[model samples]
Target chain A: MSHVTDEVKGYIGVETDVGRCWDVVERGAVRRFAQAIMDLDPAFMSEEYAAQTPYGKPVAPPLFPLMQNRLPYDGTDVISERADDPDYDGTGGAGPSSNLPPLPLGNLALLNGGSEVELFRYLHHGEGLSFRHRYADIYERETSKGLMVFVITETDYLDDDGGLVARVKRTTIRR
Target chain B: MRDNDAARADAPADPRHFEDVSLGERLGDLQKGPFTTPHLMRWSAAIENWHKIHYDRDFTQQHDKLPDLLVNGSLKQNFLLQIVKDWATPHGWPWKVSFQFRAMDVVGSTLFVWGAVKRKIPLRDFGLVELELGIRNQEDRQSTPGKATVALPYREGGPVPYPFVPPSADELAAGEARAEGA
Candidate 1:
């Protein structure tokens, strides 16, 4: 593995739009998501049960926005492009969640380290939601395997009124 | 908490009264999976990604040197959220939740997402409760461990403000002052 250089460290504080997509939180999507997580919260599915709650409407699961932002079609998709290369080791690819710049590391295995998230509100049915994403930071640490790099990206999900829904800081690891 | 038992057992929560909560109250365990290849693929499909490592055993083993088709970290996070989300339910708002995968959870492993009340801070209008949470595999090895904070309205204080609002710095200081005084 190459040393984590100054060029790589420069990516810190670098930000990208990662685009804004508008969506109406639908009941069907919420149902599927709740099922996928095995969380059968009525507030996410049963209209009669949800209307009795403070929200007065069915809402998406807490992390639903992560699913809403699908694979972006930038004409040359990093994930798809890398898939065509037979040598790809099934790592170091980006998904809809972050816009962190690709690191200088070549052909290293990657893992979704984990995340820290803050939720101020839920995305409810029929409400318009927008997501703002940016690469918050990048850093490296020495490991027994060698040197490893960690990428931190922050995303803010907002309602149409621009009120905050959730703020997420995701960590991706490369070794 | 096995995956099948917990899913079959969980019922809807009633609005929890702030007065009823106490330190060390167990937010009942949540179990998920015997997660198989199909379960992993469904999650990948749910998120609309076709990451070959999740589905292609040849690619994962021959190229990546992994033990098996790895369970999605994203999926594990969802299970972690499920525990607190349902625990808070109609009464309390799951204000903030976070966790990390301390070890890899491979395919065919069942996960038990568990949490317990850590601390409770009484606010003027509501109560903020903190808890330590984690997911453990069938073998009782813990993988993801983290903590969360939730806002629960007082039984008499009315529903948590619709579109929840986080305590500001000044409010937090005042709450701390109140907490110390109590």
Candidate 2:
């Protein structure tokens, strides 16, 4: 059974307007992120050291953009809405591409197939951010397990001035 | 917070110059895990990713039909980036990276992130080093296979330009010719 129907393919080229992140880069968040990744770079914490670096301020790690989006205080609560559903995967609400309409595939298992990222600069603390997501492509492949649909989404992470910080292409697999 | 001094000591102290790199040089490995549930939970919370496959064992096995709580491919990417960034930073920049999650490493797996220089292209101001990188379990099962491009300054030159500027078409054509000849 092919999962990539015409409706799914229609999403290609679809894009969302540039959306603001829920919060600006915060020191405590960056610190927790660094600790979770076990990367203790002083650049993420020490203003004294970071001031001498090219960025001229404490900067988050290179991939910190992945965690910038969060559920807004006034947004719908995905957790509370699905509290009674045993199958809730805890994956919805807000994310890099959450603004895009969900794929038509219903109840199919989803996987994070892979990703490609081009980083131009590290995000400095206190900087507000924005992102825009587009569905670049959609196709189906017959895998050993069965037929699977691949959804390719591209997200551009931008600083407040609209300068690009990173471009990420991610693949989502649904079977 | 962990010891920043120790982490700094472990990271490359000086800038890694393009002139100093050899084609086949191997980067020191960065190891993490026997990843526990707390590790997975901490990562999910840090990123606000509530993917149940990473934390709910019953749902993962019964519904997702997996062996155990799987390690986050998202989390593993950080390890790959860390090893590359640690080896190339302070003077260089990790310009681009791509990786595929070919296999699932369940919870309790110890992962070793590794990379090696595979190709080098010299530009007018700096150099680009291409690397083959991946993550391997303790049993040597390769899960994430990828490539990266890192920009490094010349031994006597200034640091690689920040917010890195890609080489121009003319510079790339010239670099390609030089790389082919070398």
Candidate 3:
């Protein structure tokens, strides 16, 4: 029961146009994110300290780019829309790498397999961010639990000038 | 404004130069938890990740057929980067990190993120330190296992260039050649 049908395999090399986030890096969002992770580094908040650092300004945490693809203000409410659906996993709407067409796996459970990230610089506050992602690879493996499909996606996070901020390769497992 | 004291405590007063680090040296563990649903919820909300398994215990147990409200691999990853970043920042830069979610850490688990210097490669300008890292629970069950590379300045040199310029292929080859010769 190979899930790697020709259609699924066709998604390999599928890439999205560079899309900008709805908002620039905001101080408040960075604060909440830093607090949530319990990483209270002053470089992420204290303007005074950041000025002395090499970055010269307060910056978001290294992995902040991954969360930059937020829903627009006028975006549809998938949570409300799927409130009545029992199987809705609460993950909906276009996200960082969701611009690609959905894989043909029907009713399979999704899990985050892991990721490899190469960080060039931190996202500075007030800086606009853009991303382009591609389906780098897709394959299946037989595990003790069952057969699972692994989807590898590579996303490049860039600053307003299109300078690279971080490059992330994420693996999503479908069972 | 948001507890600057903790931030200052995490910040290294002095720069960590390449010469300061030794192979096989261990970094101080970064601990978080006994993580509860609130922790997972905050992380999910912060990132706007609506994965039900992180918050909806009923769905996680009944539908997903999991043991408990599983912690977000996303959140755990921050812990991984934090340990490396906190260790390398102020003077050095965390260049690359890779990890696999080999196991799961459910709610109520306390996670300790740990890292150790595995190898050090010295280029012409700066050096790269390779580290083996992971997260383990109170029960000593390892969940996330990964490796990282951090760029550090030599003690006699300036800071590791910001917007880190990775060593060119030639520089890497020359550094490896030097290491092999030594």
Candidate 4:
């Protein structure tokens, strides 16, 4: 396996520049998302049905961008360190600093823990999307097994018209 | 009545009305064989997902250090949609669906897709039903969790149901919480 360090720096504390456009949503793209996710609702495909909605175009399914690669986030709010023991659940009574586990050799190990996404609107078909993200939170906790890193990344999706479509905060557990 | 036999057999019956459904009713479960390279490939082709990790095991091994082919994130989401829409076919569209990717759904694992109605809300013209939904592997590992809201008939006789309005995040979270409790 490639050392975790190589991919760690690329993913951890990484941010996309302002106005960097990601062709995150389009008509074909939305249709594909709808098809991929097995959502057969005609509203996602029928121009007339979607036109009745607020967006006035066939809208992409709510979670489409997440399926795309090259996610962007703001990295200003990250904290990294080696852990003494990495198996601690983040539910410790104290605040982030005290409850954090040790970091290991500045070596990064990360995996998808889970996330919460809030959608305000759908990405209308054929619309260009630009987004930027930020490191919402980062900390470490110790456990009998080893130390692990708890990282939260937040990505904001915007349309070419500059309206917010959705926001997602993904938490990754790195050991 | 004797003359109506041919007409009755030829004409398809109307979809079941939403009024016929009850809370906690199941749509029946769908099971797929253990995941495999071909299954993943078909799903990927259908969705046009080109993520290296999903198809290229070598890349996954070298870059992400993950085991065999990682399932497409969207595929799991698709499975949830399939389970819900199939159950709701009688009612028509349920407007909103939002879910989170919980864990990597790997190959060689059987998945059971299922859902149950939690409650029904009456609207001025139509009714909105909230659903608690999930997809799990054979080992009972939940791969995805989310909520769907469907529009139903206010009374026994109503206009053909239309696509439902998808629920907002708050609504989905509340529904998810309820499902967790169950």
Candidate 5:
């Protein structure tokens, strides 16, 4: 690990075109993710079961968006180039590259941090969801491991009623 | 409360007051285990997360230099949600919640999920409860940290009505057309 100056910029914000909103919210994708996660809960699969519940409709498991949404192709293609392009089977890895810019920003060692989300209601298949993403903040701190940079981002999801369905905040750390 | 005693605590001191909660209220902690590549495989297959970073170490190292098979960030978030749901259920508290991704949770790390209430509002239907959340690895380094808002049962009320749902037919069709064009 290398110790260096806090070369971190504050939050940056971006918007997803309305057209891409449905890319991840499809009913088939929702079912696939629900099964993949072993969330064999009946409500996620059965319309009849779901209709009996308070939701009165087939609902995807909570946290469905995290499972459904894919990173945009523009971003994915950029990383694929960096990963040197490898055969995929739904796992993590890019490839060996001595020179890859820092995640989002340039010149930093970024690590996979973690995130937390709250579900206002379980998302259902064929249900349309829209989101606006904003970078919230960045903090510089010292860790025993070394210098660390924390980037926090927030995405707001709205439903047909224009009511906010869920808001997801993600933070990543780079050294 | 003593750690041992808290461990054995059946429920919160008062259930109704759960809605009257404040920022300092400790929501307790939960432990998970044996998260492995197979776990990731199962989840990935189910979700169809074709992204290579989740499964291939060579791909990750060559491209991003990530450590061995990484745990899905969403899995960690699910763990957080499961913990909170488990903690609240004994008291018969069911709520609607919202959260953000704060970090990437890798394999071989032990996570301790905790939170504190940050704000509260009384909606006509339910209590709006907001809290700051944190998921720290065993190293005491916080991996992902963010905020959350939940719709809790009113102290004197029953349950909150569903406030968030998808758009209308016209709206969805328009969204579909826009998406296809894009």
Candidate 6:
């Protein structure tokens, strides 16, 4: 018997803006990210060093663009909003941050299941990237924790020239 | 993965050759953290997700059933990429990677990201190196388990193709057939 409803299954091909960052890959931003991750690879950080590499200029770490998203609000709005529910996860609590469609399964806990990624090229400084997302599938299974839903989404990060940057298949587990 | 610190220090300064790699060869360990609140905070700020599960111990423990502030999966993936990317750079391309978030690593623990060459296949232009990799906490508990395929240049070549294109469908089918035959 299926625990997932027909309506939920209908989302199999639904689209979401999981993220879309078209801004130029900034060097400062790349440095901050690499520093935070503690990856001091010159390919990602130093333009002088990267200039000597095959890429000719500093490139964002392969996965750096995935984290580069701009929220639609200013900082004050968020601070004021977070003043109440001290328990708030800083997720703005206003919406599912990824722009994922509201799940019919209310209040269900969402967990990161895993991901499959294909990288075609390095995203470099001065390059702009765009994202396209779709609900690839939704299914349910009986786990030791009881019934859980697995939602898979496919996102493509494309360069301005329509070149492939990275293609990701992300899975979210709902319990 | 083999951790030959002596061998790593003696690694060639030039691009690596696919012919040099062997199955079961261990990659240099890429370590990150003893991550603290500031580390988590920086990552959250960079990614723009203030999910308190990573910073708020009270909410994470009381509201959610977690022991402490959790390291962000987003952060983990980036570290995974860095491990493969730095290892592949100057020669190889970290072409395709897949990893699962099997377990959670709470903040305040160092992570040893390790990789080992699992297999290699000869291709028309270059060779494909498959690797098994993961993140291990201070206690040696694995968290993110992954597999990656890297394309390496032949020693005679100048460099792997820039903006490396994905193999076409025909190429993939042929590769599959070859694998089955082998």
Q: How is the predicted docking of candidate 3 categorized under the CAPRI scheme? A: medium
Residue lDDT tens for model 1, A1-175: 4546788777667766635653477677777677677776666766677777777777888888776765445434666667578876543333555345676777767788888889887777878777776767777888775687887878887788888888888888876
Give the top-scoring candidate (DockQ): 3
Top model by lDDT, which number? 3
Clash pairs (backbone) in predicted model 1: none
- TM-score of the first chain in candidate 1 relative to the native first chain: 0.82
| TM agreement with the true structure for every prediction | 0.90, 0.96, 0.96, 0.56, 0.60, 0.88
**lDDT of model 5, residue A155:** 63
lDDT of 1 by residue, B26-135 (tens): 98887788889999988877766666778899988888787889898988998878778767866788888787766888889988888999887888889888889998
Backbone Cα, N, C clashes tallied per candidate: 0, 0, 0, 33, 41, 3
- List model 2 lDDT by residue over A58-165, tens digit each: 899889997688999899999899989887888789877789999888888888898999988998888999999999999999889888888999999999889889
Can you tell me which runs of candidate 5 are displaced by over 4 Å? Answer: A1-19, A71-104, A107-109, A116-118, B1-33, B45-53, B58-67, B86-158, B164-182
Q: Is candidate 2 or candidate 4 better by lDDT?
A: 2
**DockQ for all models:** 0.53, 0.63, 0.65, 0.10, 0.19, 0.50
Candidate 4 docking quality: incorrect, acceptable, medium or high: incorrect
lDDT per model, in order?
Answer: 0.76, 0.87, 0.88, 0.56, 0.54, 0.76
What's the TM-score of chain A alone for every prediction? 0.82, 0.97, 0.96, 0.62, 0.70, 0.82
lDDT by residue (A27-121, candidate 6, tens digit) is 88887877777765666656677767778877888887666545645324565676785444455433222555756876565677888899888
lDDT of 6 by residue, B1-182 (tens): 22212223222257778888887998878778888999999988776677778898887888777889999888888777777876787567888988898888998988889899997776667777889989999999999999998888889865788787666767766755664575
Better of 3 and 6 by lDDT: 3
**What is the overall TM-score of model 5 with all chains considered together?**
0.60
TM-score of candidate 6 against the unseen true structure: 0.88
iRMS, all models: 3.1, 2.8, 2.6, 12.1, 8.5, 4.5
lDDT of 4 at B166: 49
Give candidate 1 misplaced runs (Cα > 4 Å). Answer: A1-3, A22-24, A72-83, A89-94, A98-100, B1-12, B180-182
Residue pairs with backbone overlap in model 6: A89-B50, A89-B51, A89-B52
